[model samples]
Target: MDPSEVEFLGEKQLVSIVPNFSFGIIHLISGSVGPFRAGLPVKVPIWLAISLKQQQKCRIIAQEWMDIEKLNDSIEAEKRSKLFTKMPSNHFMDEAQMLLMVAPDDIPDADNIRTAVKDIWDLRMSKLRSSVIGFVKNAGTYAKLDHLTAMEINSIRSLLPDALDIMLHMEHGGKPTVLQSLNTTM
Candidate 1:
């Protein structure tokens, strides 16, 4: 699966809404949603919220952690913590991007939200890059690392095959293919 898809597997889709009219409970396999009423906020899934919004039945209320500052802080905290820290939602950034596009009024700091997501992604990518370098340097002596986050593993997965190939070639006394190509045509 795509790294982002894997990352968002545990996404929480809860959203708050103010419906335009009274309604009965929405039955689902997971659970029931709501007996929606106009002018009163009721928590529902993003899918339902979007449907209501599109139909002009409700206005969306964004989550508390939807702010840019909060997201940046969360990213920093995750970096500092030795263990994984739970984010507000697994797919917050992706979900927020869609929400902002479809309902910009619901999110107050739309610009900052975009910036925050980009910053967090960049920070994680930098960390991933460093970790991969460290992993490569420690290859022969490598044992198990029990602390890597799912993001880190996902970031490194694509590079692993090539790295293993290089290690195997070196162990069998072959120079790196790239070095050999330095003197070759095409």
Candidate 2:
């Protein structure tokens, strides 16, 4: 019979006799060799065999994939976060570090991460100072008296001027906000 004249029957016709024969072929060949280039009669079959072999190799390699390195990197990141305080490392250094970590590819982006860190640090410091001041203010009449002896009153009054200077500096240093008003208008 001529090759072109041969017809492969569909699988459904043989369901009762050989249910698993869902595929059919006229001629099948397999081999481990070949350039099987165009203009060669055997090229098509050879190329199909090579493709099947490569696909099987890929499946085997994929099965051995591991995530150990990713796990280790995640653990290291957690440790670093714990060791470092979230406060900005002074203003300029903080900005430099944030820019390095989050380099802009395009667009005029503000360093939001740095801004957030500074804001949180400022809030925490404000709360702490307020608490300290409140405690000292409520301690007693002795807390306000200048009769506490020369050395003690000098130490207390010295802290007062520095605290006042910081409050004044913060008031004029940035965008106007309600918090700044609380500190400055007092």
Candidate 3:
């Protein structure tokens, strides 16, 4: 059969077909969410279906690599070290198990998984910034803004604009008071 004449099923779960081997081609497609089972009839070309499946797999692998690279660049090594110490290997294993606890019959959606990952990434970034600011403020012993060095003052100033921007973007008022409080406390 010519490759171009093949048809495939792109379902997330195992695809069921009568007389499975009767098809000219069969391909297993894996994505971030789950795997898909595809089959081509004798009349369809096998090569075309296989090529499409391979393309899909390549795209998924590329996306995963990009995500991992982004995560590695964004997270600080010190923070990661602290996280690893707090969570421990057993905790990571438990979390991994929980993540993969879905039933065999249930196939997760790729788009949904991508969206979830994006949301979690955003949340973590926000938390990281907040914690860093908190740590700096807590560690400084300066009693007044005048007592702070130029670099320290600049750092605090930089954080204030971003914090205010976030508050404004969220439509939360009282940004001035928050800034004043942070200035006096730090």
Candidate 4:
């Protein structure tokens, strides 16, 4: 999914790149970037790296944690944990997809990244499904879900309203649920 603008822009990453040409330092609100040199590595923001890569000015080194090995470890750790574990980044898959699209050759094991990402996504989805099932089984009107990403909330948005409507219908005698209302033919 294309993440919200705020999430995408707010993601700060250290991207290593080898510049094709030399240039003076570039200043940003975050910090001063680099006085670039040909064939020398420099760390720049992911946004700036994407821009420079698009312009054919640099070869981006993928984040260390973006590798297949690291991702496998992360997924395993998450699966072993009872609670929702922190992912490498909240919108990592989105960011990785974008960067790989622009500079596939520059990233190490670009081909495997997709497969690794998919595996991690599937595992997380399974966990999420279990959580939703648990939530439904619990006899409670309200519950707080902290530490979930915005994308996670959006995924369950449609289900929440219907579930709430059904809860209300169960509490109040003979009131139509949202599903019942939607099922009516005009």
- On lDDT, the candidate that comes out on top is 4
Q: lDDT by residue for model 3 over 1-186, one digit each (tens)?
A: 221111122111122121222222345354221133233212222223233334442111112222433334434442444321221111222122222232211223434444443543444445455655675555532323322222223445656656545645456454465657798999
Off by over 4 Å in 2: 1-110, 140-186
lDDT of 2 by residue, 81-183 (tens): 4222332122222222323233322112334434433444344445445644875555422323311222222334546555655565566685676766899
Specify the poorest-scoring 10-residue window by lDDT in model 2. Answer: 9-18
What is candidate 4's lDDT per residue for 115-136, written digit by digit as tens?
A: 8877777777777778877877
Clashes of each: 0, 0, 2, 0
What Cα-based lDDT does every candidate model obtain? Answer: 0.70, 0.32, 0.33, 0.76
On lDDT, who's better, 1 or 4? 4
TM-score of each: 0.67, 0.21, 0.23, 0.74
Residue 140 miss distance in model 1 (angstroms) = 7.5
lDDT of 2 at 21: 16
The superposed Cα distance between candidate 2 and the true structure at residue 177, in angstroms, equals 42
Give the lDDT ranking, best first.
4, 1, 3, 2
User: For residue 159, what is the lDDT in candidate 2?
Assistant: 67
TM-score of 4: 0.74
> Which candidate would rank higher by lDDT, 1 or 2?
1
Q: Which lDDT value does model 2 have at 77?
A: 45
Give the clashing pairs for model 2: none
